[model samples]
Target: MTVPPPPWRRAPSPRKRAEKPLLSPELVVRTALDILAAEGIRAVSMRRVAQQLETGPASLYAYVSNKEELDELMLDAVLGEIPCPEPDPEHWDEQVKEQVRRQVRAMMTYPGIAKVAWNTPIPVTPNALRQGEAMLAFLRAGGLDRKQAAFAGDALSMYAKAFAYEASGWTFGEYDPAHMAERERRMADYVQSLPAGAFPNLARIGQFFNAGTSADRMEFALETFVAGLRAVVRA
Candidate 1:
């Protein structure tokens, strides 16, 4: 009876499922970030990540509660990559700006990671808390009270996240340069066509609309914010 049926006639030997690799928090986060890097944020999902890890979406819940939690984890992982410098009282303002610059640069590496940070308010993740602590130290070095430092740090974070999101859009080629150039040209033409008296301010500044590189703009923004911190502290 065991003389064997023909290979094709034999019922497929109950296909042996490949053993799934063990799941861990680090693995889950790394999988998600890999998906983000390869296919952008929109392609990353519990199902997608689980598929990449050779499991089901339900399996990811043991490691991450949900997509939002996954995003927080991803952002925290990115934050972990950035160095937190010691506070320098003599150059605290520059130090603060440098910290923000580092954050923006790191988030931009993964394109949409900054958006995740932007959506999360008061993230309690370890690296996020570390970043907050470092920023607070910088502000304290510059003479802000705890309340002022907290407020300033929050504002600076928002500004950096917003700028990172914007920079990512351009840096990652989300918008085609040729298309953007055409759109800008049409916009400039439309602005020029408007009556000068009806929209005097718009007409005056319209020429400078796309005048600066993103780095130039970021430099201006950071310098302005840091320079204004003392006034805010006094107020």
Candidate 2:
């Protein structure tokens, strides 16, 4: 007989070959969101996510059709966490700002979720639609017409998403507090070293650069934007 396959070439153990449970789209999306939260968005992929679930890429197809769909799912999932407040005309400005703040906080916690949030189409998820309705309601209660309310909501949301995305991008890799401080010092020095006359504002404010806490920046931005909204409403 042809030299039989060596004993060392035996097939895998039968126990190890058992079929895995059917993978669902929800499972894939949840695992992907976890991966995105733990690692950066770059760490999320069909192959990697499938590996996390102990399955093959082919199996994931039974649920998520493609990367785009998975991204949409993750974004909607993130949006789901934001609680929609009842429209309170007396506190609509504060309410809307708080909602945006909460959303930004949630997105920042998940690292790359901000990027996904930016380009994801108008989400059709129940939570997302409900949020939109609530936002429009709040704006309208604050005296905006339907079209103005819709546009203002979209513009403010875009700003929040972009701000959070940039903030997340800055903290992507292994972050060390000491190292970050050193880097900030270097940046401040660089700015300060610029020709003082040519860059008076930057040189003068070098000490202020990267000096504020995330909360401080968020509050400042919120106040400024809301003040602008008040002006718009009054106009």
Candidate 3:
């Protein structure tokens, strides 16, 4: 009869197998955010993230339960980039506007995160909670009562998130000078072609419609909203 392999050579003991270092939730979240920033939100998946980490999907499960948890973690990670400001009653309006601008800028940096952010429930992450606390403090310093401060903060954040999400849908290539110029020309021509009496405002302001830069539009919108908030709070 042929000699059989020794039983001792059958397999290595579980204890002798190399132990994999525990994959931390923070590391997994950071990698997911990196993937999201490079490739849009749709590109982020547990398997894909695992591939990037050079591990099996099961390894990710040890940290993130599912894609939803990963997304929430990623959103929180991005929110952490915005720094909270010290509340100053003398400059509450300016501070609020600056903070909102920072939030929008952070969302824009990540491309698709803003769209996913608003859909996620008010995030429970410390960074997100800190942002809320800062906003509330600023509003209260502006003389708003507790309920008013809370509601105002929610409204302002919702507006900022909505605007950022809408803006993100427009790709960078679509904003090239030449492309925008052509777009403006087309838009103006279309508006001018409308019956004069039907769209007088649009026709008359056709040039003005394309006059300002994107930065100008953003500033104008922020100013108008802040002005309205001041009126409402003072009233």
Write down the TM-score of every candidate: 0.83, 0.81, 0.79
Show model 1 residue runs off by greater than 4 Å: 1-20, 171-179, 197-201, 204-212, 230-235
* Number of residue pairs clashing in candidate 2, backbone atoms closer than 3 angstroms, sequence gap of 3 or more or interchain: 0
lDDT per model vs. reference: 0.88, 0.82, 0.81
| Model 2 ranges with Cα > 4 A deviation | 1-22, 174-190
Worst 10 residues of 2 by lDDT: 205-214
Candidate 2: Cα lDDT at 175: 58
Comparing 1 and 3 by lDDT, which wins? 1
Model 1, span 74-112: residue lDDT tens: 999999999998999999988999999999998888888
Number of the candidate with higher lDDT, 2 or 3 = 2
Q: Across residues 4-49, which tens digit of lDDT does each residue of candidate 3 receive?
A: 7798786655677576555899889888888877877768899998
The pairs that clash in candidate 3 are none
Candidate with the larger TM-score of 1 and 2: 1
